[model samples]
Each structure stands twice: as structure tokens, then as C-alpha cells.
Target: MNVLDLLEQWKQSDTFNNTLSDDHQVISYQEAYLRISVYSDWLASNSFTQPMAFYCAQSIEHLLMLIALMFNEVNFVLLPVKSTDVDKELFADQLTLKPHFCDMLRHIQLTKQAQCKTVATPGRIYFKTSGSLGTPKLVVHQRHNLIANSRNVLTRLPLNASSRVLIPVPMHHMYGFGAALWPCLLVGASIHLTSNLNILRFKAVERQFAPTVAYLTPSTVGALLLRSCKSSQYEFIVSAGDCFDRQTFQQAQTKFGRVFNLYGSTELGVVAIGEIQSKGEAVDDCVTALPGVKIKIESEQIAVKHPFGFDFYLYQQTRDVFFNTGDLARGDEITGFSVIGRAKLSINREGRLIAFSELESQIKQHQHIQDVALVKGRKDSKGHTIVAIVESTTELAPDELRRQLGKFLPRYATPSKIIIEPQLPRLVSGKINRKQIALHYEETEF
Candidate 1:
């Protein structure tokens, strides 16, 4: 259903009383709709045809403006909720956006105007892909794509009017918007959106409104698990990002009842939902595909096609019927499928191509290592070399890490350089900033 229809249906039913709480205040569905309408009316009057990018204010108003724009011209790009100048210049050649959107306060101030009502203008929503292997690209989708994808999630997950979801991820990212916001809004479920995620802040939220489902990243999950909160109201723990190793997954399932590692891309909303297995069931990283979604391995890359999947990538100049998610995956009848790594992250060393993420996963198996990131260093005469940056819970030596990885991976996949650090850098969406890490080690020698 369309957003307006969804909101109207909720208003007509008992769901209108359901709450949408942020860090500061709590408001009911009807209350939020009134606020959103005020912003949307302003957008509908200002005419625009070209796609425009946005900077996040990280408030209830940002969401209101997005909902408002969706009701109007529909074509707007969300630059990954990060405060960067690149987002400002993305549509520079195409659209003229007056009054740059900086990080203001809770509400967005749009100069209001009145124009004659027009037909509902529908357009695409472009989200920035995680720039793990290379430069980030935009994934173009529509409101229907988001609605269909959220419906798929709602169909799979046990969510209803009574469900309360915790949304810690940024609203600008597809994971937070498509996975958290749309599903919660469409299903008439309440959401507890936190401005900050920490021991004191989250504990406060838990005391006020007990969250049923937590859609968080592995990093956030790790931090949350360490907290001494006396609450156990979490029924489902949803996580994405490559950092979800077997150890993290099992620990989450132990604490929270059911933990599902959502395997998805911004291009294809959510392809599979792998129930993070317990201690040992011969963990195979098997993720079951959603209905009506087709998956295949072309040139060893995971290719997907679904109704919810977007067709073109405007920035990359890629137009395809099947979105070839440069991710490397393996599937069979028994094991289903497993997403291993990205095709762009593969390092060709001595004619053997090794996925950096796959190699990093193998290294993370070493008990002492807390986190790992693999980056491609400068190419010497032998070829491109791999660098492993380790974040260990306990003390770890580089030589010992290599000795451990030698048992799990081949020599070609082994990191030529190991940099020890207290923590690994991450993007807003919880994906490793492999782009940044790669640039860091690129200037150094092995």
C-alpha cells in the first residue's frame, strides 16, 4: 500500500495510538502524521524534476521531510546519512537545490508556498552502497520497492501491532529505512529510535519502552551485549554487515531468542534471512531466500533478480535486468546459499583470486582476534598483497595470527601485512570503511 493509504488505514484503526519515540520525545501515529503533512505540503508546492541529495539532521524532522518529499516529486537521493561535501555535489550538474541542507535541529525549515494540487509524482530513491571494495555507488529504487521489501520482511518476521522495534541505525541508510522504518510503519508497529547508542542511553530506553526487535549492526550488537542491563524483552535480534562472524552470531542468539543475519544490498532490498545458528549445527552460513526472489552464480558472483530489486545504477552507468551484486556467494540444494565476499574485493595473487572478506573471516576465527579488516596494499612485482588489520580482545601477535590463518586459509589468501589496532574504523551503516583502511595501508610497505 502507498504511504498515505498506510497512514490512513492506521488512523482508521486502533494502530493510530501506537507511538514513534525518539531520544527526546514520544508522539503517537496521528501526531506524527500531522507534523509530516506540514513539511510535505511545503515540498509539494516547490516544484522540482531532477533528483536531489540530502544531508541528515538526525531528527524526527528529517524523516518528516522524506515522507513529505515522497508525497510530492518522489525523486530524491539520500547521501549516506554522513556529513560529507561529496553528497552536496552529486546532483550539481542536474539540479539546482537552493539553501544547502546542513545539520540543523529537530525540525527541517522549508520555505512554505502554495501551488495548485497536481497528480502524485512518483520517482526513484537512490541509496549509497557500502564502499567496501571501491568508490560508493547509488542504488536507485522506488517507494513500491521499499513497500514490497518491507512486506516481505513483515511476512517472514513475527511482527504485529504489539511489536516494539529499536532502530539505532541511521534513517538515511536503506537498512534503517527499508528494514526498520518501513516495516514498523507499514505493520503499524511502534519504534524506539535512539539518537545515541550507549550503556546509559539504551538502558534508559529499555526502562521506558521494552523493545521487541532490535535492528542493529554487529558493532552495536557487540556493545549492547556488554551492557549490564536487566532487561530481556528482546525477542528478535536482526543484524547485517560482514562483521557478523560465527562467534558474534551465536552470542547474540544466546542473549536474544532468535538472531537473524539479514543478507541484503541496497540494490536488492533483502534477498535472504539466515537464522544465526546456535553453538554447533555444523554452521554453514545458510541463508534462505525470500519468496519470488531468484538467485544465481554468474562468473562466481551472486546475481539476483526480484520485484523489489532496482534495475539501474545511475552513478556506475550500470543498467541491468538482474542486479549482479558483486558479492561472491555459493549455494546448493542442501545448504541453500551463503554470501562470502564482494567480487571487487578479490585480490589476484600469483593467479589465485582470494576474496578479502573471506580471508578476513578466516582470520577472525582465531579466538583472540576481536575484529579484522582486509585491504589491498600496493602491487609489487609478485602482484597485489593483502593487509590484515586486527582488533583483539586479548593481546595478539602478528606472527601468531599468520600461523593461525595458515591452518584455515591458503598461502595466497594470507595477509602479507598485519596491523594491530584497538578498534577497526566503521561507516555510519556499520560496514567496514575498507576504502579508508585501504588508503591508510596503501602508503606503507609490508
Candidate 2:
């Protein structure tokens, strides 16, 4: 079903709260629906109909603009407001669409150009990855794929009409769009969008709204844990986009109880959800895949098949209909299945290859190591050197840690350099900032 149809359903529902907070500054579902209608009406007055670029910050106007685009049956690209002017210009040129800036003055001038498309045929939604790996490539998804994935995720999390959900992540990212926005829209759950990721702000909103569930990233979860907030406020806490480390999970459980760790990517919707137990053990891996969705592992790489799948672009051509995720996973009866690491990041020393996650999992077992990220450093005339950037609480001599790792991993697999740091840099999604860490080594005196 089209997302706009869901908005229509929400408009009719009286049980859900359309507004949140004492400020009453936040838009209610009813208010959002009306704004969407108004925006659609504005678009219809003009003749512009093709896909447009949506560049807006986190606000009521931004949310309504997105819903209006969906309702008007227009395919629009969601661009992060954090992007530079050059980046925005380049993106608009690449997509062959006019840029719609959401500032007060710009909004008035651009409304005339925001022509609504009258086509009844459903269009595709596009999201770009962080340009860390080359230029950020655009990933396309059909309406059906999004709806199916949303339905599949809801089946596992079990959100209903009465459920109040908090969306802490940015809507531009697929994790935020699929996990927070789409699920709430489809299930008719009340959505609470925070302007920013501040612990005090989030807690205050929680006390006021009392949402049953919250969609968050590992970094945001880490912040919540650092503050030692009460987790009993939310019944279900779902984390995605990055790995939920044991320390973060344990701290969260201390306050909030249990949280469901979800695994997926922008290319391959929601793949699995594992219940992380109190003892820091992933209890199950048998994620309930959506109907018509099949998982296959070829050469240790996980691939997915679905009737409604992403139409990825490769070398200027629309590649395969099926998505072969570059992630590595192993299927088993006990844990069911688990993602070990990304294929691109796996290190191969000489002829012997080893998964980065395997090394990380092994090193994390060590009491001294607070957190660690395994990466391929530099190759000498001999071979490639496996490097481990570790976040440690105390001084654990690199030599001593190297000896410890030797007990489990082979000499070649052990990281040649164990660089100790006060803390590890991480992306918004909670993945290690490898590029930033690599730069640190390059610029350091030692």
C-alpha cells in the first residue's frame, strides 16, 4: 500500500495522539495529515511533477513535506541538511532534479516550483549511503518493498495502534526511515520526533509522552547508557544501523531491561532481530523473515531474494534484481545465524584469511580491552599487517595484549600494532570510524 494511504487511515483514528509535549510545538498526526494535504494542494496549483530533491532539517515542516511527496505520488530524494553547498549542488545535478531548500524565505519562493505529479503509478524512493566509500551511491526502493519490510519488522516487534514510538534517528537514513517512520505509519503508532539527540531532552520527552517503544542507533544508546537513564520508561527498545556492544547493552538493560538488536542494511531491508540476553549472550539468530523472502549464503556472503527488493545501480546500469549483501554470516542451530563482519573489511594475510569480527569477538573476551576495532593497516614487503585500535580503561601494554591474543588467534591473524586510545571514534550509526582512526595513526608522533 502507498504510504499516503496509511496517513489517511491515521487521520481517521481518534485513539492516537496527534500532538505531543507541553510546548505543543510538535505536530500531531492529525496536524501532519492536514499539512500534507495543504502541501499537496500547493503542489497541484503548479505544473511541476517530476522527482524533486527534499533538503530540510528535523521539524514539522520537513515531516509534512515528505508525507505530501508520498501522497502526491512523487518520487523525491531526501538529502541531509548537514551536506555542504557543493555536495547539495552535485546531488541535484546527478539526480536531474531541482533542489527545494526548506528555509522560510526559500520555502515561499520554491512553492511555485513544487508541482505535484498527477500520475497514478507508484514511484520509487531513493536514499544515498554516507560517501565514505567513493561517492555516495543512490539506492532505490519501491513502495511495496518498504511496506513489506515494515510489516515484517512489526511482526517481530509487535507494535499496534495504541503503541507510542519515539524516532531518535534522522529520517534521511534508511535505518531511520524503515525502522522508525515507516513502521509507525503502517501500524498507526504515535510518533515522537526529537529535534536532536540530547539525553536530557530525550528523557524529558519520554516522561511527557511515555512511548512504548523507541528506535535508536548504538551511539544514541551509548549516550543513554552513559547518562544512566531509567529504561523502564520504554517497554521495547530496538537498536539498528550498527553493532550493539555488550557494555552498552548491559548498561542499557540495567535501566531499560531488555532490548532487541536488529540487523540489516540500506540495500537489504530488515534481515534479522536477535534477543541479547542479560549475560551478554545473543540468545537467538532465527529472525522471522518476511513472506516471500529467502536468505542464501554463497561463499560465506549473505544474499537475499525477494519479490520486492532494491533495484541497485552498478556501472551506470541497473544491476541484479536480487541483492547480494557484502556482509558475512554463519547459520547455526543454537544462535540460528549471526553476521560476522563486512566482506570488504575482512583481512587476508598472505593466503590465510580471517574475519575482522572474529578477531574483535576474541579480543573483547579479554578483560582489559574495553572496545576494539580490527582493520587492515599497511602491507610491507612481507605481507599486510593486521592493526587493532583498542579503547582501553587501563594501561595494557601492547606486547602483553599481543601475547594474550596469540593464545586464541594465529600469529599472522593477531594485530601487529595494538594502538591504545582513551576512546574509539564512531559514526552516527555506531560503527567504528576507521577512516578517522587511520588518519590518527598517520598524524601521530608514535
Candidate 3:
């Protein structure tokens, strides 16, 4: 069903009084609908003939604006308010949104020069990647596919009318907008949007809202472990965007309720999610693909065939039957797949290929190493030298780290050099900035 069909269903649901809240205030779905109706009416009067870039802030008003836009069938590109200059340059015309959002729409103005194509049908949404791995481009998903993606996630995950979901990630992201928020909207679940969340803020919101479900990233999970927060029993929690060590996962399971590892991307909405566990069942490392989504491993790289995948990248007509994710995986469809590393980042060491993600995973197993990134440093007659940048729980010598790693890794597999840093740079999605790190240390002497 499309977004409009979902909205009609929500209007007739018994849980119409379910609330959507943030730090500012709480509003029921009833009030939200009234605001959306008024805003959509205003949008109809002041129609935007060309595609405009939209700044989506983490607030209830922004959510309302999104719903209104979908209903009005306005073609727009979604971007975070704190977007970079490069992002703004992609779209010359902008749609400015303000506080008390609907009232400001009456005077909303669009600048000249449209860069994006306007779809004949409504419900087109574009989300760009963080460019952590490579150049960021706009990934387009039809409105119906987005709703279907949410349904696919719900089939694996459990959310109901009584469920209360706490979302700390930016709504502009697919992880938040598709996997989390859209699912809540479909099920009539309450949503609490937390902005600029930290350890202290997380604790405060927890005490106040008592959310039954939460959508978190690995970085947020790391923060909780660092703060030594108490165990919080909830329906379930889903973590994604990056991989963490087994130790971190076990520690998180102890502190929080059952934690599930979710694997998804911008092109394909919610590809796979951890299998649901019965009461008293242990959590598994394998994640099963959602219904109708096919997963295959080719040349150690993961490939996906998602029925509800995006149409295509903006200004590019390349669409493959099986999208090569560029990520390494090892598992059959029956057993489920586990993401190992990036296929493109593999480096040659003495004629032997090594996936740095596997190296980083092994390094993370060390008690002191909280996080680590293995990047290709330089190439010579010998081979490409591997450099390891580590974030540790305590001060540790680089020589000592190499010695510790040597016990498990072969002499050739050991990192040629190790750099100890307290904090490593990460993108908004919690993935390490390997591209940035590689560019920064490209000229370092091996």
C-alpha cells in the first residue's frame, strides 16, 4: 500500500490517540493529522512546480512536513539542516521550513533553477550516503517501496500499537526515517525523537519516557558501555551502521535487553535484520534477509536482490539485477549471512589478500582496544603496508599492541604500524572514516 493508504488506515485505527513526542512536547496522532491536513492544503495553494531541496530537522514539525509533502505529492530532495556546502551545491533551489512549520508554509518561497527531475507521481524521496567509503550520491526510493520496506522490517522485528519507540538517530537518515519511524507510523506506535543525544541525555530520556523499543547505532552502544549504564529491560533494540567486537556485543546485551544486529543500506532499505528470539533463547550472530529479499555471496562479496529496492541513483540510470554491496560476507541462505569487510578495501600483503575489516575485528577482540581501523598505507616492491589506527580504553604502547596482535595474527598479517589515539573519527552512521583516514596518512613513511 502507498503512504496515502497508510494514512487512511491510521485515521480509522483505534490507536489514533497514540503520541509522538520529543524533548519539547508530546502530540497525539489526532493532533498530528490535523496539522498535516492544514499544511497539505497550504501546499496545494502555493504549489512548487519544480523539485526543491528540503532541510529535515530532528523534530515533530519536520515529520509533519514530510507527511504533508507526501500527501501533496511534492517532489523534493531531503537533506539535514547542517548539510555541507557540497550538498547544497547539488540543488540550487531550496524549500525553507521554519518553526511552527505549517504557518510558515503560507509564505514559503522557492528559488529559481531546478537540478533534480520532477517525478510524474508523488511520494519520491531521495537520501544521499555519508561518503565515508566513497563519493556520496542521492539514492532514490519510491514512496510505496519505502512503506513496503518498513513492512519487511516489521515482519522480522516486532512492533505493535502499544509499542513505544525511542529514536536518537537523525530522521534524515534511512536507518531512522525508514526502518524506525516509518514502521512506527504503520503500526500506530508512539515515537520519541531525541536530538543531540549523549550519555546524560540518554539516561534522562530513558527515565522520562520508558521506551519499550529503541533504534541505536554502534557508537551509541559504545557510549552506553563507556558510561557503565544500568541494565534496561525493553521489548528489543536494533543496532546497525557498523560492526562491533563480540565483547562489546555481550556487554551491551547484559546492560540492555536483547540486542539485534541489523544490516541495511541506502539503496536497499532494510535488507536484513537479526532473527527474533524466543524468551530465554540466546542471541545469534547471523541475520536473516527480510521476506522477498535475496542474499548471495559472490567472490566473498555480498550481493542483494531486493524487490523493494530503490529505482536508481539521481542522474544515473545504472541499475543492476543483483546489487553488489562491496561488503564481504560468509554464510549460506539457510544459516544467514554475517558481514565481514569491504571488498574494495582489501589489501595485498606478500601476494596474499587481506580484508582489513577482518583485521580490525580481530584487533577489537583485544581487551584494551575499544575500536580500530586498518587502512592501506603505502605500496612498494614488498607489498601494500597496512596501518592500524586504534582507540583504546587506556594508554597502550604501539609496540606492545603489535606484540599482543602477533600472538593471533601471522607475521605478514600483523599491521606494519600501529597508532594509538583515544578517539577515532566516525561518520554520522557510526562507520569509521576510512576514506578520510587514508587520505590523511597517505604520505606517512613506512
- Which 10-residue span in candidate 2 carries the lowest summed lDDT? 90-99
Q: Model 3, range 353-403, lDDT digits (tens) per residue?
A: 466766677778889999988777776533577788888866668888888
Give the poorly placed runs of model 3, Cα more than 4 Å off: 1-4, 85-92, 99-122, 226-233, 276-283, 346-446
Writing each residue's lDDT as its tens digit, candidate 2 over 20-126 gives 32223565666656666777776667555345566655555666667666666666566776654223332221121123333332453342343332222246666
Between prediction 1 and prediction 2, the one with superior lDDT is: 1
Give the distance in Å from residue 12's predicted Cα in candidate 1 to where it truly belongs.
5.1
Question: Tens digit of lDDT per residue, candidate 1, span 132-206?
Answer: 333466667776777789889876777777789888877777778877787887777888876568767777777
lDDT of every predicted structure (CA atoms) = 0.68, 0.64, 0.75
Runs in model 1 with CA error above 4 Å? 85-107, 110-122, 132-134, 227-231, 243-247, 279-284, 298-300, 315-318, 333-335, 346-446
What TM-score, computed on C-alpha atoms, does each candidate reach?
0.70, 0.68, 0.73
Better of 1 and 2 by TM-score: 1
Better of 2 and 3 by lDDT: 3
The ten-residue window of minimal lDDT in model 3 covers 275-284
Candidate 2 positional error at 445, Å:
13
